[model samples]
Target chain A: MRIAVDLLGGDDAPAVVVDGALRAVRADPDLNLLLVGPSEAADAVIAALDPVDRARITVRPVRDAVRMSDHPSAAREASTVRDAVAAVRDGTADAMVSAGSTGATVTAAALGLGRWPTIRNPALVATLPAVGGPVVLLDVGGSLEPRAGILARHAVLGAAYAAVAHAIDAPRVGLLSVGTEAGKGDRARRTADPVLAAEPLPCNARYVGLVEGYDVSSGARADVVVTDGFTGNVLLKAVEGAYAMAGGPPAGGGVPRAAALLGVSGTVVVCHGAAVAADVASGIALAAHLWRHRATDQMAALLAGHAWKGHDHIIDTEVTTP
Target chain B: MRIAVDLLGGDDAPAVVVDGALRAVRADPDLNLLLVGPSEAADAVIAALDPVDRARITVRPVRDAVRMSDHPSAAREASTVRDAVAAVRDGTADAMVSAGSTGATVTAAALGLGRWPTIRNPALVATLPAVGGPVVLLDVGGSLEPRAGILARHAVLGAAYAAVAHAIDAPRVGLLSVGTEAGKGDRARRTADPVLAAEPLPCNARYVGLVEGYDVSSGARADVVVTDGFTGNVLLKAVEGAYAMAGGPPAGGGVPRAAALLGVSGTVVVCHGAAVAADVASGIALAAHLWRHRATDQMAALLAGHAWKGHDHIIDTEVTTP
Candidate 1:
């Protein structure tokens, strides 16, 4: 499988991304990389590999990259992220990975590949290994201000992704909130609780009423946790910080630096902007794994079985707390 | 100083509360407690102490308690939490501590003690030990849907509390958001960001723009982090879960079980509902520390210097994201 790697996507771009690409290419014998950045960065990867095996690597040679501080609209212009999405659209790459700005990547993928039916807000799903199993957390930074209906839609996406990607039977889904009680969150959570309860989930997943932050790491209450991108992004980073404070991660694993972007009609992985070489390598590996699993197509097929009109109904009942 | 203890509070009440009282009384020679619950629970505290030292303990003997599942309005009735608050109001206790439902505790404290001047929404502040110093987080669960104005008010309270309670000189305050960029979070954060940056902070604290979730634990960006109650509450618990997942807490400490309820007339500490014996003792100790430092009164005095009228302007600019 060929995965497009954005060479100038991270804070320490080119250097870390090049090192990560070398590690990813060396780890997987069948993996081929389409380096999507400056030629010098691509040469760094090619020079590190054996002469005979260098044929597995190719270069797109894009110059500019979207900065972390740039607006999402900046992705509309020429950039490595936009080019990577185009490669996926043209079927030159099975999947793409970027350790750049999450907003830019989401915008580029949604614009180039197009979103799935009825998914106005795409979700970035991350799986953290828990004591019980893998816990799926969505909208890590995809749609920062999703309404209740959008959150309900994400519940469906997360359930389907958990089943297809992780092969978990009857994944238990829970809405992330301040408390586990039925009505214990802000306006969005209070409105989404009942909507999610009524919405039919695919893959035999059942909606657990509500879950607290602890459930994200323990995975005892639910295998899948749905939240707004704002909260999920913060929670994911706080967990990462806590792991760092505690010396290192547990025996299971550390926080997943790579997250899958759902709703867009392609396999895409977005890494943390402050990603190290290992994090970038993991993002590349995650992209390859998702592409091999055909997880996106399977989730779309499962989602097609249901009639999703929650977006239309969201306008009437959305909460305005002012 | 005398502190009132809600013996019927928490999931594991009476048992842990009685044990906690014993530990607290043994630790502090001048500390006195007014146990509010069934007579038997109070008797357990007295029975464990020597006859001469038993004089430090008193009993209110209120049987009813607001359950964790009960509504916050339930605290308005004749519950143990209300009685404990009444003891503080009547000069029998200097402060109060409860490990019951946070909603019930906030409600009981707000109603019984009354809110401070110009502070319509009370904030629950928690102090976390970070590598740099003690990072103070506010609005943990008091106001779930605070407007930008309320968040600005919380920034002031968090700053003062950090100075008086934790002795952090000229603390740096930051508004919590998805990203550190100016316009990176939900509507509330975007609205609150500029308001906080412009609002004058008490105790010489300065606003440091927006900070991500990792700052809450790292203390690398800001000494005091401000957010709406929903995000702060969930983020606190998630950090605790991360610590638990990483074998144990750092050498500094774990997520604080006790949080101080600001914007009220009296000093109060609310422990987590799932608090253990050690957690209860820590809550009692925190209450005693705040009372000794006169944190509530000092904060109120400092706040009097500012003309906090942000609440009046919130209605006009609050985002209605449908």
Candidate 2:
């Protein structure tokens, strides 16, 4: 399958992205890339591949790109990210990957692919390799100020994504908080705990009550961990930093620099802005895996079976509550 | 110096507390402990020490304790934690250490010792051993719902703490957020960024703008990282978990099971409720170090020189704002 790659995303754009693109294409003979950026950057990738493998690369040739300093709304402009999303919309590519500003990618994807019904806020789900299994963490940078209902909705998304993406049956979903006990977090967590427990989870998943930060890396408490964008983003980075300080990650793997953009209709992956070439390559590989699994569509179908009534009203009320 | 030990605190109360107290007393020749809990638990510690070392331990019998499930305010009763606070307040001990519910310890300490002027919320500061130096993180579990003013206040606290506790001169203080770029986080961070930048820091410290979670372990961005108690607590635990997953902490040390309680008048140390005997001993050692350095009083004296005028008004307005 073909995946659209944003050539001018990330801190060291073009060079690292091109290098990553080459690595991913060479690693998987069947993987084709729709390079959406300046022709020069795309040609850089094309020149590196052999004549027989060159046909796997196609150029969309968008000139402008959203910079790291640009606002999330800048994706509305004619940029590489926008064009990459457009390629996916037109079926030129099965999925898209960008190592750019997370906000911009999320904005472009939500606007271009359309968010799933009953999901006002999209989630960026990252999987951490734990001893027991993979621990899925969500909202790494999607909705920053999620109310109780939004969190409950994310619980449903995380469970479905875990089941579809990782093939973990009956995933135990836990709300990330300061403590594992009830009423151990700020106002947001205190309100969301009961809401999550009451909400019906898809894929036979069950809410495992409140969990502490230790559970994120240990995976001893839950298979899926749900948190607001702000905490999840910071926690993910902190864990990565800790692994770095400790010399290296466990034998399993380190924190994935790429995260799936859930709640959108199309398959999209957002890599960390500070990602290196290997991280970008992994982002492309993750996109291909998700596309082949049809994980996004499968998750949407699973969510459709679970009715989420009255959540919107509850979220509205909670948001307006001082 | 004498440190009051909360013998009935922690998940595995009495047993671990007694074991920790014995370890602490044996490690420091000049260290003395005032045991506050059931007589049996105190007797166990006294029984373990040699006759010559027995004088280093003093027993204050109090059978009741604030259970993990009890409300933080339960420390108001005649529990071990509350009695430990009384020991500090009455000059029966120079400092106190508790491997107990953080809420109970914070509440008890604040009520017993009185809060420092201009400091409404107490802060629990933890230091992580990074590659370059120690990175001091504040408000680990002291103030959960901190407004912008509280965060700005914490910046000042963290700066002085790094200088006094760790002897890091001119510490670079950074606000923890999702991204390093200006205006990259939620409304709370966006509001607090400028406020922290504007606030004058003690110990020749300066604000380093926003920093990501990686800075917490790498010490690459700032020596002092400030955030609300909720975020700080979770990040600390997550980093600890990461270190555990990576085999062990870096050669320096792992996440400290104990954190220093700031913004209160007396010296207090709060250990993780899941703390083992070694963690309790380290908490005692931390308390002894602070007592020797008079860190609590030094921080208060330093803060007194900095004008915090108009902060309360801004905090009130922001809290009331939608």
Candidate 3:
């Protein structure tokens, strides 16, 4: 499979991204990368590769890269991340990976690839390896405002993604809140709990009312934990910090630095902006895995089959302005 | 110092509470406790203690206990937590500890002990042992909705709390957000950032822009991390879960099960509803330490001296309706 790599995306862009691209090509023989960035950065990756593997590496020269200080809408400009998305849009690459600002990557992908009809806001889903199994958390920097409709829609996306990507059958979906009981959270949680419960879930997923923060790391309560982007983003980082404090992560694994962006038409993976070389490499691998499994198309079909017919009005009324 | 203990508060209440009270009296010879609950539950504590130590324990019989299912307003009734607050109010106990519904405990404490005039919302502060020092996090289940004024006030409470409770000098206070960069979080965080920066802090505290979830556990950025209660609550629990999954906590300590409530007139410590016997014992210890240090009185004086004179209009206009 071919993946477009945004070499000028991370905090240590070009250097780390070049190192990551070299590693990805070496690790997977069948994997090919279309490096999108300045000519020098792409050359850094190609120069390091062995002559035999150079055939698997391609370059799309784009000088301008999105900086962290730039606004998300800056993706509208001709930047590396936008070009990476364009590569996937034009069928030059099967998927794309970026370690730029999450907002910029989301904007570029949503604008370039177009979003799924039913999904108003795209979600960034991160999977944590827990005791029982992997726990899928969604909207981890996508939609910040905690509206009931957004949460419900994300819940659907999460369940389908868990089933398609992770091969979890009949995933147990839970709404992340302060407490596990109904009406246990703030106004948004209280409003979202019932809406999520009433909404029909795809892939035989069942709504498990409300779950607390502990459930996110334990993975004993639910497989798919849905929350607003703000809480999910902070919680994910806090867990990463805790693992570091405890010496290291559990045998299962550490918190993921890369998250799959759902709701966009093409497969996309976003690495943490401060991600290391290994993190970027893993992000490229994630993008390849998703493309190989046809996860995005499968999730789209599943969602289409179980559309929010009963909750269309709520979704329509609560379309948040970015 | 005498502390009022709510015997019928937690999930395994009366039993764990009785055990916890016994441990507290045994550990601190000078400590005295006023047990508020059924006579049998109080007697259970006295029966387990030595004859000499038994004198340190007194009972105020109140059968009605607010269950988790009950509304937080139910604290207005003569429940065990309410009675415990009354004991503190009437000077029978210098402080109070409860392993009950946080909302109910906040309600009982706020109503019986009264609130500080400048602070409109009461904040629950938890201290985590970090690499540098103890990191103080506030509003862990107090105010859920994220109003900029409430967050700004919480930053003040957290800063003073670190200096007074944890003995951190010139505590570096930070507003918790998705990223350390300015304007990187949700609308609430974006609005609160500048307000907190402009607000004058007590105890030589200084605002350190925005810090991420990693700062909360690492304590590398700020001694005090401030956020709305919803985010704080989940972040704390998620950290706890991560530690558990990683085998155990670091040598410094684990996530605190007890949090000190600020903005109330009397010293109050609220434990996790699912607290164990050890957690309850530690909570009682925390309350005793606070009372001995006169933390509540000191914080109130500090807040009063450095009142929100510059931001009074914002505080007055954004008074949340509980």
Candidate 4:
């Protein structure tokens, strides 16, 4: 299977991306890679690789990348991310990965691959290392304010992804809130509690009502925790900050530097803007794992059974219209 | 000044509360206490005090206390928290402190003391330990929304509180968001970003665009960080959780176990539900400090200057009606 890597992505791009590519290619003999960026950057990786394994590498040359100087919207015209997405659609690659501007990549993927039937918002899922196990947190930076219907949709998506991607069956789903009370949290949360309660879940997943912030670190309350992207992003970084404050992360792992973008038609992984070589390698590995599992297709099928009828109206009135 | 203390106010109530009162009374020579709760619990404090200090203690018998089980609405009823608030309102006590339910304290305070003019939602503010200095975070559990107007008002309240209570001059105020970019963050943040920027801040506080979770811990950015109650509450708990996970806390201090409830007509500090002896003592100290500094009155006066003309109306119309 072939995967496209957006070489001109991340804070320390090309160099880290090249280093990660060499590591990913060396680790998986069956993995075929398409480096989608500048030839000079691709040459850096090829020069370092074993000559005999060079046949597995493909280069799709693209100029100009999303730079720190460029506007986030400039990513639309950057060409690298869009080319990466195109490779997936054209079947030249099974999946793609970019550690670039999240908004840019998201916009590119949505425009190129087209969203699923009911998913108006694609969710970015990160696996946080916790005491009990890895806590799968969704919408890390996708939709900012999720409506009741969208939250219910995310719950279904997160559950199926946990089962198909993480091999966790019957994943417990939870709504993140200030308290675990029946009626706690902001207006949207209070409104969505009843919706999440009644919605049907995939993979035998059950909604565990409200869960607190500590639960994200403990992994005791739920396997799949759902929240709007805004809160989820800050919470993710806060946990990372906590680990930093603690000298280092716990034994299991640290806050994931890479997150899998679920709900898209193909497998995609995103790294932190400040990603290092190790972070890039992890993102590549995560993308490969998702591709091997055929997790996206499986998750999609599971979600198809749980259709949300009231979602469109909710989005139009509650979210989009404003 | 006589301060009524609820001996049965926290998870380690009575024992810790009694121990805490002893510490406060001994530490602050000018302090006089009116221990209100079960007489046996109040007796614990009297028993620990020396003969000279014993004369300073008074007991008010309360058969029932507000349990963690008691709903927030119960605070408006005839409970210890209500009684504590009433003592101050009726001129029997100068101020009050509780380590009981926050919702209950908020309810009791709003009902008994009445809100500051035009202040519909009173906020909970906590001072976190930061490397650069103390970072004053607000709305730890006040209102949870992105109303541009309320956030702007919180900016003023936070600034005034910093100047009066924390003694920070020309405090730098920041709006919490996912990114530091001008247009970064979800809808509320995006809208409120400009609002806060345009707000005529009090006490020479300046708006410092957007800040992330790191600023809250490091205090390298704005002195006063403002966000919706939902994010602030969860973020505060998460920080406390982080401090615990990191093995105790930083040398400077731990996450403040007690928070000062702002936007009310009087000085009030609410401790954690699981507050220990030292935590209660600190809460009492915070209340005394604020009272001594005339912080509450000054903050009220500050709000009076920048008061959102119809904040309560907005709360009633935008939140409760839905």
| TM-scores of the candidates in the order shown | 0.97, 0.96, 0.97, 0.92
Once superposed on the true structure, which residue ranges of model 3 sit more than 4 Å away at CA?
Answer: A309-322, B309-322
Instruction: Kindly report which residue stretches of model 1 are placed more than 4 angstroms away from their true locations once superposed.
Output: A309-311, A314-322, B313-322
* Candidate number that wins on TM-score, 3 or 4: 3
Question: Which docking band does candidate 1 fall into?
Answer: medium
Instruction: Identify the superior model by lDDT, candidate 3 or candidate 4.
Output: 3
DockQ for all candidate structures vs. native: 0.59, 0.62, 0.72, 0.43
Q: 2 or 4: which has the higher TM-score?
A: 2
DockQ category of candidate 2:
medium
Cα lDDT tens digits, model 4, A1-322, are 8889999988888889999898889998999899999999998888888899898899999987876445656656747988999999999999998988777777778778887777776788998877777789987887788677777777888888888888887999999887787878888899888888888788888999998787787788899998888888878877776666556677777888888887678888888877888888888888999989998888878767766644653355232210
Which of the CAPRI classes, incorrect, acceptable, medium or high, describes model 4?
Answer: acceptable
Please give the distance, in angstroms, between residue A137's alpha carbon in candidate 1 and its true position after superposition. 0.2
Worst 10 residues of 3 chain B by lDDT: B313-322
Give each candidate's interface RMSD in Å.
3.7, 3.7, 1.7, 3.1
TM-score, second chain, candidate 2: 0.96
Cα displacement (angstroms), candidate 2, residue A134, comes to 0.3
Alpha carbon lDDT of each predicted model: 0.88, 0.88, 0.89, 0.81
Look at candidate 3 and tell me the lDDT of residue A55: 88
